[model samples]
Target chain A: METFSVIFQLLLALSILVVLHELGHFIPARIFKIRVEKFYLFFNPWFSLFKYKKGDTEYGIGWLPLGGFVKIAGMIDESMDTDQMKQPAKPDEFRSKPAWQRLIVMIGGVIVNILLAFFLYAMIAFVWGKDYVKNEDHIHGIEVLTPTLVGDNLFQNGDKIISIEDEPLSELMQANNKMLINQAKNYTIERNGELVNITIQDEGIDYMLKKESIVFIPRVPTQIDSVMPTGIAQELGLKKGDQIQQINGMDVSMFDQFRKELTTMKENNLDSFDLVVNRNGQELAFSSRFDTTYKLGFQNVFFLTHDFKKTHISYSLGQAIPEGIALAQTTLMDYVNQFKLIFTKKEAVKKVGGFGTIARIFPTTWDWKIFWSRTAFLSVVLAFMNILPIPALDGGHVMFLIYEMISGRPPSDKFLEKAQMFGFFILLFVMLYANGNDFYRWFTGQ
Target chain B: MAYYIGVGIAVVIIAFFMAATQKARGYNFWRYFIVSIVVVAGIYMMIENLVLNPK
Candidate 1:
């Protein structure tokens, strides 16, 4: 059910974003009196779901769900409206516009996306504010899952997380994860209320980079919180408030211990477990079969309830605009840096993802906060992507305009065509590769 | 957040100046400024990530 809802929300979010993006271009073209031949919510090559001709525009929904486009008259875009270009240029056409006007029409969509992202962010901020977890509040420090150790090898459970390197853990962990991402090495913590020092390597910091993941807590009680009616737990008579203490004669002191033992059962193909529970201080025993993985009737907190602490950020409307703009700028810069790292052999950019990763970002249910946050983040992503000085994008068009403004002469149409085609292929390849990464992960169950 | 926030502030300034002075010819001050900002920020983020990370 969760997966189904996630897929549904993903489709809705993508559709809305793509449509608004195309509309951003469409509205400007109409305002500038340019003839819009086709206004589509997605690319329609072979067929379309719906199309209507009205006032020089054929509005429709396309079959392809990847992206959308607005076909302007006499414009050389993905639409390949070459036949219109071959004819005499009309006054109300994109090719016949002033350089400045044409530039806006080309970049109008990008501007709209950026603005839309900002507005969404502001609304989300006003509505839900912001929530974050302090590293110190983890109580249980991060567990090292890697097979190798690079730190001053005293890493162990129950170690009090004091600081990364020498920085205060609370301040660093308080903000938008800048601390963890920015500083990925060194350590200062208190073990048994005594300060200790350790040096950790940056090689395994990617795990922490995942924006959302479940962090397990050791020595926690294993009370059955709830159960799905048709779930394995329900079928096994698991009830809320049942305190599970032992599993298959293993004295489980914590929920984590129970999980670790259950994972080992997979090797033996044991899909069932004997659960010892203390119901109202009376010891009880039962058997339950595992479903999917080895998940049992352990209580799990709702996402919103999982972290109780609040990180409130207040900014006036006057302040938030600039703040919002700044947020976009920084995100754009970070994206550019990541891209440069990939190009310069500094970091692996192949990890950059497409749809599957985007879908993965959504929570199991329809949480407006999560939706808007992811949407705003993607908006920034789109803004950064379109601003790249590649030939097929707005940045590419901007590059041409800048060159024309400087040299007082546009590049020859033949050269422009070749460059555009080259750029188109490059973008196409990138989209395919990114989306292919999603497919690969899904197929391999990674 | 602070590091990224600083970068955000810098980008806005660069964009504003670039858009404001786009018509003028000669030297391309805005372009140089943007490039410098990116370089400086890039180096800063890298160093901060490597040397001064909070444990």
Candidate 2:
């Protein structure tokens, strides 16, 4: 069921993006009176799964799911219709069109992709609004789990985060995520009622990403919600409503801290460990044996529970449009900055994910809100990728058209054809490298 | 045996297309058969090195 939902969402999202992207070109080409020979949802090497001809265009779904294409008449695209290039160009053909019209035709897809992203984001906001916790909600301050890399030198327990580089934050967009994504230099924290400035290094940001557990969360108190019937918690006589105060004689205020304590105890091969719990205002000590899973099998009160303070604002349609557009713009800018890290940061290579990783990012169950959110983000990615000035892409075609407009001479048909083929090869190489990384990671259990 | 035949079929298809394109462009005098051989061999080697022999 999980696999089916993932596959279904992936296909639907791709289909929507591909069809709209192709329409971007198709609409312009039609307006310019260019004869579109074919509009395919995917590539058909030997044959198409389904097809129908209407007017001068044949619309079809192809067998290959790699990508979709629109074949324009008199254009030397990946179709390699060199035979038609030998014949005289007709008035309704793409090659016969003016440079300005051709440029519009080339950019149609990218423009549509950008608009689609913004529109989807708006719809998402209007429907789901935004749910978040305020910066003041971290009643026990933020939990820091990375003791090795990001030690107390960077932050102490119970240190209330005030702002990142003078920017106040909530649990939403303008918050911790922005700090990591931007790799901001300094942040302010309220430690002991005194605002102290903490400087962050680049490695600190990278560590936060590599060990995603290190991301700050509201330090929920280690109060037990329920204990398993058959686990060590049962044997240890731990009960519900017990607030665990210490593990291995070390103080542990937060659930995350308690977890780190357990992990370290297991690593040190300590089978027997003790826990101090505040039961009915009595400090009770209990000893327990470590299980293979290194878990005491007890649920703890954490984020999303009634204990953590949360706020949600349901947006009216009128309020959603501008907010959605702002969100979309920020998302694009964030992606662009993060992409730069691929060149600057060495470990960024490991973070690069392909189609498979994308498929897995969706919820295991069919949730329309998350599905639409992911689709919107993907649309932004498609726009950025398609607008790159690489051969065979929309940006590539636009580049040549711009050159033609400025120079008043279009490149030869043979040159265009060769460039298209070269673009296909480059795209193929990139696809292989990305998907191969996915396969490599899966195979090696990384 | 089935896999080899599939590879052979692919080689023939690509070679035929490349050969026909070369001929249609009025390169009939320059031994288009050699182009077919190179295409077939070149594609086969690429598949072997990249797909079959992972390193």
Candidate 3:
């Protein structure tokens, strides 16, 4: 059922994007009187699931969910209808159209994708607003959670993060993630009102790549928020609002420390275990005889478990428009930065995922906010990818058109066909490799 | 999944047949070799990178 929700969202998002994107081309091609042979969602290899003929076009859904295409007459698209190109160009064929017209038809899909991204983001902002925890909100500051974190001397306890990888920290919730995402080796922290620059050693990278991913934890005390009825904590006279300061005579200041102490106690099965709690400015002690579970039924104050305060602000439609556009722009830039890392950083390439990875990002339960946000991000990615000058893509056709406009000559049909095949193979290899990686990881439990 | 594998197997066999026919039609040996290698290399890459690559 969880997998179903994920797959359903992915398919719905892809289908929407593909259909709208094809329409971007379909509309312009129709305007130019270029006969569109078929407009199908997903590729129809051997046969289509269902199809219907309309004026000069066959609309259908293909069994293959890879992608969709609009086959314009006299065009050497993925359909690769060379036989149609063999005959002299007809009046209503794509080849008979002006070069400028052809360029617009080629670029229409990318333009639509970009606009769609902006629209989705704008709607998201207007409906959901933005929720974040600013860096300044982390009054108690953070702890370098990565094991050994370069060394003991680099970051002092309760050090406020100033910046990472030279970028000022904005969202405290995302600070640790930003560290891993940027593959950062250096950061600035404010200790005792003085800024210090710390450069992590090579071991830090290994920690980010191989082990527990979190790089920092907010320094906060462990305070009980609820006492579970008929459980260990209630039986031991532990009540809510008890700020646990020690367990098994070991000092525990933070919530993470409390959890760690519990785990250690459970593993060792120590005969004597006690909790030291400060309740209402009064110190109290409680004994424990934990079973294998080592479960303290009292739940911690989850909201206060972190240091930062969350902020959410809604926007009017007018304000959201620019905000959404800027959001889309930044998403595109961030995606491009990450994409380039695939070539520059060895570790980055290893992390590349396929459909499985994409599916995992969706919420297990239907969430409109996250669903739209992810889909919008995908739209931006689609726009950027389509605009890359790959021969089998729309950008390929535009590249040829640009060449024709510049050199006052179109490339021979045979040449375009060869280029298309070369580009198609490269694309096929990339898709298979990424998906194969997914298969490998699933099979080997890597 | 079975359909996908079936298509892949069919494609490989047909490609080999086409390459042989191209040879009969006076295509260069290098052309046929390139086609075969590309098909084989593509499959090899998927297995090597995703499953077999050392951590």
Candidate 4:
């Protein structure tokens, strides 16, 4: 059922983007008097699920959900319509159009993708507003992931991240981006009632990306908020407001730390362990055996009980337009920055995911806010990817068209055909490699 | 054990597709066959180290 929802959302988002992207080309081609042979929502190799012809254009939905296309007359695209290209150029065909017109036609899809991103973001802002936790609101500091903290001693278990370099950290959400994008030299943190500076290393950034781990999260005390009547905690007489202090004589103050200690106990083959909890200013000890699933069977204190507060920024319809554009600009820039890491950092390639990873991002139960945000982000990604100067992509055609406009000589049709084939193979290789990584990860339960 | 079997199957399928592509594109069979093996091996090693066998 969860898988079904993910697949549904992925398909729905892709279909919307594909249709809009094709319309970007179809509209301009029609205005410029270029004949459009087909406008498809997906690739139809041998047959389409549904199709209809109207006024020199066949509108259809293809069975393959990979992507869609608008086939302009006399255009040598993925369709590889070389037979028609060999014939004399018709006045209404794409080949007979001026260089500028052809360039616009080629770039139309990318333009529409960007515009769709901006529109979605604007609508989202107007409807839901932006909500994020401020850095200062993390009164309990941060609970560093054990692996990350142990691997790199730059951060302690309860360290408050004050600033990256000299800039004050404003939003908790922006910390990782600021660190990665700026490549900060120093991290200032409030630790053990004193300010300390930790030198940032490029290797640390690489490690985080390689591991795909959140280095640290906001720390909250492990206080019992609820206990099941038939659970082990209730059986042991544990009540609400009891602060867990230690497990088996090992210090475990935070909820995550307590959980980690239990995991370590299970790994050590310990069936029973002692837990010390502070109740009403008095320390008390209790012993309990792990259940079959290795759980204590109690709920920890919720984060809302802490001082953390979410700051919301609402906008009027008029205000949303500029804010939305600004959001889109930052989103595109951030994506490009991250994309560059894939090439520079050797381990970054492992982070590249296929359909499985994409599906996991969607909530099992649908939420419109998350769906719109993911769709907007995917739109930006699609726009950037299609604009790469690789043959068989929109960017490749635009690159050639620009060259022709500048040099006053178009590359031969045969050369274009070969380039298209080469580009197709390169894309195929990348797709297989990415999907193979997904398969390997899933099969190994990574 | 499963990793080895999966890679073996992938190599066979990739080789078959590589052959089909080479035939369709009128390229030398042996040249692309070797290239396909190298590419597949490289991808497999990468997945092992970066993903499956990460420290």
Chain B structural similarity (TM-score) per candidate: 0.47, 0.66, 0.45, 0.73
TM-score of the first chain of model 1: 0.71
Query: Chain A of model 3, TM-score against the native?
Result: 0.87
Q: How accurate locally is residue A91 in candidate 2, as Cα lDDT from 0 to 100?
A: 100
TM-score of 4: 0.82
TM for every model, in the order presented, reads 0.65, 0.83, 0.83, 0.82
Query: Which docking category, incorrect, acceptable, medium or high, applies to candidate 3?
Result: incorrect
TM-score-best of 2 and 3: 2
Candidate 2 lDDT over A201-221, as tens digits, reads 765567765764345656778
Report the lDDT tens digits of candidate 4 across residue range A1-446: 88888999999998998899889899999999999988888666556789999999988887667777787888887546676888999999998999999999888989999999999999999999888788888777777653544424477767888988789998754666765655566888888789988885674566567677645567888888888777789889999889999988988888878888888878888888899999999999999887777777678876655546878999999988888889889999988988888888877777778878777778899999999988988889889999999998999999999999999999999999989877866776677777777877898998
| lDDT (Cα, tens digit) per residue for candidate 3, span A113-174 | 99999999999999999987777886767766665763546865578888988888886656
Report the lDDT of model 1 for residue A426.
70
Q: lDDT of candidate 4?
A: 0.80
Clash-forming residue pairs, model 3:
none
Quick one: best lDDT, which candidate?
Answer: 4
Better of 1 and 2 by TM-score: 2
Scored against the true structure, residue A291 in model 3 reaches a CA lDDT of 62
Q: Give the whole-model CA lDDT for all candidates, comma-separated.
A: 0.65, 0.78, 0.78, 0.80
